[model samples]
Structures are given as structure tokens and as C-alpha cells.
Target: MLAEYRQFVLPRQRGLHAEIIIIPTGELKVNIKEKNNSLKAEFDELYFHSAGKETELVCRDQLGTESVRWHLHLANDDARELAMLIESAEEEFEALMRDL
Candidate 1:
């Protein structure tokens, strides 16, 4: 998941830039078995940002919670186009999750 995200954002830069941060929540869940009655699981949060503004993308999932934020600093063009691109990416991510 992390790799995919990096690939998605790292290649596109026409004067725009983005950053991704992954933070571990350090929380775990336990399950009952018999001999091995517990399992280890980890949760994390993902933050995405561009320009300067921040936006939340994903916040609830089995792998952990994630959020994406985007900032747009438009110089000559309208910011709406950039906004649309971010929105499209968000939707694409959601669809990918569903497939998983």
C-alpha cells in the first residue's frame, strides 16, 4: 500500500509537490485460538499533503486507519483543476481498497 501510494504521487510534478507520512498507532488486537490464543496486529495512520492545505482520505480499515490531505498552491492556473485531480485520486484509492 505504501509503495503504491508513493508511486502514484512521486511522478507527477509540474511545479506541484506532495508528501506522505505513515505513523504507527502501536495498538494491537488479540484473538482466541487454543495453543496460540493470540495474534499480533498493528494499526497505522497515513497522512497525505500537497502545497499546504490538508485533507483526510481514509480513516477506517482492517489494516489500520489512514487519512490524506492535499494542499494546492496555484500560481497562474485555477486551483480547481488540482482539486479535481486530488479528488479523483482519492476515489481511485477507495476503489483499490474495495478490490483488496
Candidate 2:
């Protein structure tokens, strides 16, 4: 699979707690640590418009990787399904951002 959807709370570190929601892109590695009484997150993923435009989205063969990396190829109905996924994510994200 090209992507995996995962949501869970990160382990507590130092003095802070964190939560994470993984969005599809490739193999995501998230690390959370405490910093100044707050939470910090690190990952490999899609952020803003610059994401998903590089070799990160490429398949294992194309990337010459040891792991069997996956890639997505959407067409017609499949493309529509992707669109729906995005819309659904966006709707919830918008609600989340309302407090910002």
C-alpha cells in the first residue's frame, strides 16, 4: 500500500504529552520529544503544497530501495475516491483549525 492511516497518542516525554495523526505519503516515522514544557514532533510526510512532489512517492523499483515501497496510481473512479478522502480530511481539519 502506498499509504497507511494511523492515529494515536504519542508517548509522554519529559513533561509534555503529544498526539499524532498520520496522513498518507509513504513510510512515515514519527518521533515526539518534550521541549520547554511542550511537545515536538518529527516525521517524514506531506506538509503544505511542497509535499508528494519528489521521489518519496516513487515505488521501490523506481527508487531502488531495499524495501518493497509502494506507490499510488489513481484513475477515473479511483481518482474520485482519492478526492473524497481529501475532502473528508479537509473538513475535519478545518474544524480543528477553527480554534486557531
Candidate 3:
């Protein structure tokens, strides 16, 4: 919606991450959770947006389709704030790791 990203990362598990490319031709979407806990090491899909907090995480349902859980909207300042906090926590985690 704002700009185009060449490559993006998606999650499959608690510590697993998958790299994906955002096709500029289609609508941007992301799948966070796997159905029935059938995930192996990555999420159901990947998304491309948000510098860090300006993003959304979608959880698809209905078994084999692209539904949404955190789809974007006309406004998402609160959501963005939450995401920013998560990112900040991760950064702090990395700092902790370095300290350890």
C-alpha cells in the first residue's frame, strides 16, 4: 500500500523464520499460524510491508484459503504501536544476548 519490498521474512515457529519476496502484482498478505498445529518450521505464508511496526500479521483459516487476522486498514496507529513494542523487545533481547 505504501511502497514495495523486495524480500521479507515470515515466521513458522517460535524461533524459525522464512524469507520471502513480495510480488508487487498481488495484494499484500501474511499467514502467521498454521492450521491444526501442522507447522514444521515456518509460517503458512509471507508478507511484504511495514518498516517494522507498520505491518500486520494475518492468521488464515478455513483450511486452505487466505483469510485474515491482522489485515491492514485505513488507520492502525495502536496496532503499529503494539508492533513497535514487540520490535523493541526483540532488540532488547538481542542486546541481552550480546551482554550474556
lDDT of each: 0.33, 0.33, 0.36
Q: Write the per-residue lDDT of candidate 3 for residues 1-100, one digit (tens) a residue.
A: 1222222233223432322222223233332332222221113343325444444544455366676444332114534543444445456656766788
In model 1, the runs with Cα more than 4 Å from the true position are: 1-77
Q: Model 1, residue 59: displacement in angstroms?
A: 19
Q: Write the per-residue lDDT of candidate 1 for residues 1-100, one digit (tens) a residue.
A: 2211221122223533333222122322322222233323222332233443323232234453342322223322223333344445556657777898
TM-score ranking, best first: 3, 2, 1
**RMSD, each candidate, Å?**
14.7, 14.2, 14.9
Top of the candidates by TM-score: 3
Lowest lDDT sum, 10 consecutive residues, model 1, at 1-10
lDDT of 2 by residue, 1-100 (tens): 1233332222222333222233432223323334322222122222212133221222233333455333322223433443454445555556666766
**Which 10 residues in a row give candidate 3 its minimum summed lDDT?**
34-43
Q: What is the lDDT of residue 69 in candidate 3?
A: 41
TM-score of every prediction relative to native: 0.28, 0.29, 0.32
Superposed by TM-score, candidate 2 places the C-alpha of residue 48 at a distance from the truth, in angstroms, of 16
Residue pairs clashing in model 3 are 11-43, 12-42, 12-43
